[model samples]
Every structure is written in structure tokens, then in C-alpha cells.
Target: MEDIGYGLLDRAMIHQITERWRHGGIGIIVLQLRHVNAASLEAVQLWESQQTRLFWRYRMENDYFFFLNRMKSDRQMKLILDSAITSLKKGLQAAAAESSVDERAKPPFTIGTASASPSGLGRSAETMIYHALRDATLSMLRLRMKEDETELPFGSGQAGARSEWSSSVGIGILAKAIPTFDLHAQVSSLAKLFESNTHVQGAVIVNQGRPVGLVMKEKMHQMLAGQFGLPLYWNRSVEKIMDDDSLVVDASIPVEQVAQLAMARDISRLYDVVTITRNGKLLGAASIRSILECITNLRTEEARTANPLTGLPGNAAIQREMKQRIESRQPFAVIYADLDYFKWYNDCFGFAQGDALIRYTAAVLQDVTGILGGRGDFIGHIGGDDFIILTGSSAEDADKLCRNMIWRFDGGIKSFYNGEDVAHVVDRSGNRIEQNGVSVSLSLVYCDGSEDITTEHISQAAARLKKQAKQLNGSVHVMGEVFEKHLGEGRV
Candidate 1:
């Protein structure tokens, strides 16, 4: 009923509890139990141990609705609060009859006796479990929202591709909360931690829950193997040997930025684990190996979906970009570009020259938009000579962008012609044919986001404007009800 702990949204803690849900593990149910239900520590522990088998069994059968369901609610997702409480009620009644112990027993299981014989769950444990699941579910929901909001604008179309881009791979996606030790913990204890967990590369040293230093396995082992290494440091505190200058980054930062900071470390500590924090408290750590691997996966996905001809994003990425912008309800404009007489040019000069023109048109769009467009502008190739531009620029700037695109396109198109004049080109039969070259026609559609605008609406508007622009001469741009403009030989 009270506000859930904000720290539970930390990626490591969320993964830890969700991992418990996935595997029915009971060792680390709640990292900060006090943040959930502080009044009864014993009840929290009892619920964690007693409820895993039963709860996970229920989860397995209903995993479709429990784990695989996507958020259908609005931007804030207000429904998750009620959905979490509802799921808790269902999980509480699961496997009631199969247990050996009777639920109606007069004396409920006490904290001391609950662990030894967890067959009968008490009211305290039930209450604790309810709050824990509710809070955990809420935390997971918020984490998903954060990932979606910060995802790269031009990511791939895969189901979970939002978190896979190097430009938007937040540290939370890769960081895992490995074992953490107090600042005063002896070096020998850290040595044991590494021995016990061979997969762990380092231990985060915390002072009152805040990360202060990092103790890496390779460096510690190297120190201990040195002259008088064991005697000099084995019994001393870990702080004496820990890397205090280790890189610490907030969890919301992109992994690409974090990778830069990680490599900037001294060569001796280049491979040290990077600690991730939330609100200045230790959340988890990401190894250089994990960061690099995440970056590689992101880049691979980008390259897979990019337009081969011009290296711009393709249809799927374009659709996704438009969809996100529309859903965001932000005022933005769409510029749909189509080349005029492209097929005739291809027929006259062959496909090779036509392809070169397509690439050149893409370059012109990029340069014009980069100079005149607002921040976060997007450009995509919709296959062939069709391109799309989405920008948050003002109407005046949008007009300028269209005019500049036409100017640059007309100027560079002469190079593709056979002679100094762009009106004539050599045909396949070695005969000269009259051709005016290719000119761009831009269909500009502006949406204030006040109305319910869909991608279909924008596409339809662009198609309608394209028909109108083709009726005129030279390169031109047309917008609904605002203005009709043309450049070069013909003016409208």
C-alpha cells in the first residue's frame, strides 16, 4: 500500500528477484527486505523459503500472462499497479490442497519452525509474500519503461531490439550485482569470495551501501603471488589493496559511453570491472567483456537492418521511428521524398547510373537536414528513390530544409548526365535521347500531435501531396493548405 522502494528498480536487484522467479531459487529473494516489509524480517525470510515451490509452479502454467504479456496501457502504464495486486491474490491460493499440513490448523507455523517444516504457510508469510511480489512486479514494470524510453531511435525490428543498440544500451542491461563487501572486510575474505564463485571477476567495496572501490581477482591474485604478498596483505583490509580510482558510472548511461570510460583507465586496471550505481549507491558491476559484447550485438543488429545502398535505415526502422514519435505525441513533421522520372532515367542510362543517383540523393538529404533540422532528426530510405525525414523543427525551418534539398539535388545531378548539359543522355543503343535528368519532389506533412495521427495518415497525406507535386515542373515541395513552392527552371 505504501510507496515501493525505488532502489528495487536497480537492474541487478530486479534481475536477482526475477531470476528467483525463473529458477525457484530462494537464496536471494529480496536484496533489501527492509525496503519491502521492514516490520517482520522473520516473516520475509519465511515467505521467501516457503512460497518458492508453490508460487513458481503457478507461474509455470500461467507464464504467458505473467511474464510474456506486453504493456497495453498508456505512457505511464497506470494499470500495472492493479494488475500486480491481482496476480498476488491468484498466487496465494495456488497448491493449497496438495500440501500435507492443513491450512485450518489452530497454531500457525512460527518463524523458528517455518524453515524446518514449510508445509504450512502462516498469515505473516502470506502478507510478506504479497507485498514482495507486488513491489517486485512494479519495479520490473518501471524498468521496462525506462528501457523503452531511452532506446535508440533507429534500432532494429526484433521483439527485444530496443535494448540492443550501442547508442542506447543502458548500463542496467549489462550490470549484475556480484558479491559486495564492506570497506573493512579483510582481504582474505575477498580471496575466499573469488575462490567460491569462479565466475565473478571482481568484488565491489561499499561503505554504507555506496560503492567506494573495486577489488579485481587478477590484480589481487597477482599481489598475493608477489614477495611477502600473502603475509603483507592477506590479513589486512581490502581497502588497502582495492582500486579506489576505478570507474563508476550511473546505470542510465549508454554502454558505449561507459566503454570509453572503462578503456580510459590505467593499463594496469584496464580490465577492472566497472561499478554501476543508482542514486550514488552500489547497484552492480559490468565487466569490460560484457560491455564490449553488448556493443557488438547492438552494432550487428544496426548493420543487419541498414539500407545496403546508402547505409541509412530501411523500411522497418523507418516504421519504428515514426511509430515511436507518433506514440510520444510530440509535434513533428514528416518529409516524404520521391525522385521524378527515375524509371525513365534508369531506362536511358541503365541501372548503374540510376543507383548512383539514388545514393547521391540520400547524401543531399543528409547534408541539408543536418544543417537546417533540429536535434534528433531522423532520415531513412523507404527503398528505391523514396526517402523519409522526421524532424521536430519549426515550420519555417522545415520549409528551408525542403528548398535546400532541391537546390543541392539539382546542382549535383549534372555530374550524372553524359555532357555539361543535363537535358541529354546516351541511350543503350548508343543514340542520344532527350532527358531532363532526375529532380526530387518532396511531400511535407506537418502534425501538431493534437489529433490522433497514425503512420497511415502521414503516408496517405504524403502520397496525396506527391500526386500534386508531380503535376508541376522542376523540383518542388507541396504541403497541405500552407504553400506550394518550386525551384530551378519551373516556379509555382
Candidate 2:
């Protein structure tokens, strides 16, 4: 307890320990603190001191206290935390009952708990910690809501669709911060530090554990380059030269959001490295280079999953939207739209007109969804003339969307036809075609979201509904419920 090592592990040392534990296949039971302060430190220590038998201890950003848990089953892990939970309640009661204790000073505390054991070496220790921290945060939320639990949060290492991004630790940013204090320290020493470690772009200055300013290399070099400046300010406080307008962000923010925030700064501060913190304590800085690289990778992933022609999101995005809608239990409708008799039209008009028709459909879907659907409504292409739209589950809204899309396409269809085709209303090619003028078919599936649902269920239901609508005379919308009644369950 008296060792300087407690709460003092730098990022490198932390990573080293994590790699070791991860490679060794050890499971960690971490007591996650909502905040880290003197009161919280005392509470953690008091709790730690009471547990006579122990496992190796670890701390990160002074917010997460980790120890190895050798339990063979989740039930055993639950028992351990349940016992600690009881003791924590009793301690709070005792503290409240004691009138002699100071009334204003309440002990700092950890909230609900979560644990993880990194299995494959492919999973970095930092990522595991992040997932566990997210689990703890959710556990705390559920506890506050007074929800009774049958199993652990995050399904105890279960990986769902969104979990991959949700569980990731920050980018290569946390290990880059090095603290500096004693603003009066000689500039020669600062120069030596800059010279010694070529990688150190900046240092955060703190006094009594509070971030005061930031000293960046470019600013420092500019000051030193001035005539007589080095000699004049060599022995002075770096605070005089430090950039007071430092970029700071919470470490818990997702990379995508971080990119948006980091880019939203003023032109002058746009390229400044971001300072990442946890519970208001400095964790590290992510360089402008790192942020740009991260953004590029995100864009690349988006492009990879997008449709080649329509450029709308492909199946992955569509499925994800369905899953999210189901999870939120919002009254929403899933629309499957297909271009009826598009193949015959493509063969007649050649690929160029076929491509234009698809693009037109994409635009129509986007416009209708944006104009008629609620805030989160979206349109995604599933290749060819097939697409999907998610919108408010209102039956009226669905009807309007279907009607509007058909009208738009039909209104514009004449332009693609030759002048004589417009005069004749049906060319020789059109007469042979069963469908009229490149009609668009839309099928609607309504989900109340009360029942448990999966992406596959939504897709299958939409496909069946789409087939029913195609069998109609012209471009039309078919509701799955009505179709089910008309054809029975076998066809619906």
C-alpha cells in the first residue's frame, strides 16, 4: 500500500502488464470507479485492506482498479461482487449512522461492476479494458434504473453487432502524454528533453494535479528562435511560452465523434493535437496525424460497404439499421423496393439507361425518406434496382411514401423514352413487356418492436412482401399484414 507503484503506472508499463496478463489468459475482476479523488482513493484502499487474501492489483488513469479473478464460472464472479455490494451498503449505512463523522465529507465510490478475460492474443489488453469499462457503465445505469438482473451486462463477453466499435479502446493516443510541473524549471532542461526523445511533441504542465497549460514543440521552438529569447527566458517558467488554448477531450468519446469534434475547431486550432482525459485527468494526446489517419480508415470502411452504382449503403448498413430499430423498440417500418421488369428494360435500353433508372430510384428513395420519414429515416441500396428504407412505422406515412415514389418515377419515366414512344404510349418493345414504363414496387413490413426480432426476420418478411407487390398490375405498395390475410401464412 505504501509503494509508489500504486496509481503510478505510465501507459507503457500499463500496456506491458496488460500484455502479460492477456497472454497468460488471466481473467480480471475490476472495480470501476465513477470518479478518482482523495475520498475515492481512501474508499478503494479501505475496501482493498479488508480483503486479506488478494490477487495482483492494477489501476488505470486512477479510475479503474483491476485484480485477477480466478473464478471458474460467472455464478462465482456474481457471488464475489454480490458480497462486496452488501458490504458496501452496510458501510454506507454505518457512515450515515455515525453522527460524530463530518456531515459534508462523503466517501468517493465505485459504481456497478463488470469483468473480462481476454482470450485470443488478437485482442489487445486496452480493448478488453474498454469493453469491461463499458460494461460497468451500463451496469451502473441499470442499477440506477432499479432493474433486476438475471445475468451480467454486455452478456458477459458476448459480442453483438455494435459491440465491436462500442468495446474498442481509444486510438493509439493514451500512451503519448508525459507530465511536466515546476514551471520555473530551466528551458535548457526542456530543450534537452526535446532533444532526447524525438517522439515527444508536447508535454502537459500540471501543478498540484491540475492541468494549467500545454507546452508544444512548435510554440517552444518559435519562442527560442527569436533574438535573445532563449537567454532571456532560459530560466523562466514554461507557462509563459505554453499554449493556454489547448485542445482537450474526454477519453470515452468514440473515434467517429472525436473526428467530428476535433475537426470543428477554429482554423487556427484545427491542427492542434487533442488532449484525452478520463474523469478530468490527463490521459494523453492524439496527434493531428493520428486523427486524420483514423478518419481515413473510417471513410474507407464506409466506402467498402457502399453500393458501386447508387453509392448508397449496402446490406451491412441496412441490416445494422434494422437491428438498431429493433433494439430501440421504436415503431418503424422496413421498406423493400424493387424495380419491376427492370431486367427486360435493361436488355432493351442497354446498360446506360438501366444505370440511369437505378440512380433515379436511389434519389427518389432518399427524397421520400427525407421528406416524409422521421428524423432517423434512411435509404440504402442492396445492389441492382433493389433498395431498403427505414422510417416511422405509421401506416399513413408508409402509404404516402409508396405513392410519392411511384408518382415521381412515373412522372420522370417519359423523358427516358424516345419521342415516338411518348407519342405511342407503348412502343413495340413496351407492348411485349408485361409491366408498364419501368414501374417501381415497394413492399412494407411493420414491426411494433414488442417481440424479439432479428435482422434475418426483417429481411425475410420484406422479401415476401416485395414478391406480392410485384404480382400486381402496376407499381404499388403491399403491406405484409394485409398480404398475410390474403394469401395466408404459407405465401405471406
Leading candidate by TM-score = 1
Model 2 residue 265 CA deviation (Å) reads 1.6
CA shift of 467, model 2, Å = 4.1
Off by over 4 Å in 2: 1-196, 203-217, 220-260, 275-285, 300-305, 316-333, 367-378, 390-403, 419-435, 444-452, 478-492
lDDT of each residue in 328-363, candidate 1, tens digit only:
687888998998778778986889999889889988
TM-score of each model, in listed order: 0.51, 0.46
Shift in Å, residue 352, candidate 1: 2.4
- The parts of candidate 1 lying over 4 Å away from their true place are 1-165, 168-171, 207-212, 222-241, 250-252, 277-283, 320-335, 367-378, 390-403, 420-436, 443-472, 477-492
When summed lDDT is taken over every stretch of 10 residues in candidate 2, the lowest stretch is 154-163
Candidate 2 local lDDT, 151-220, one digit each (tens): 2232211111111221123543443657575556666678778878887767777655556677766557
Which ten residues in a row are the worst by lDDT in model 1? 108-117
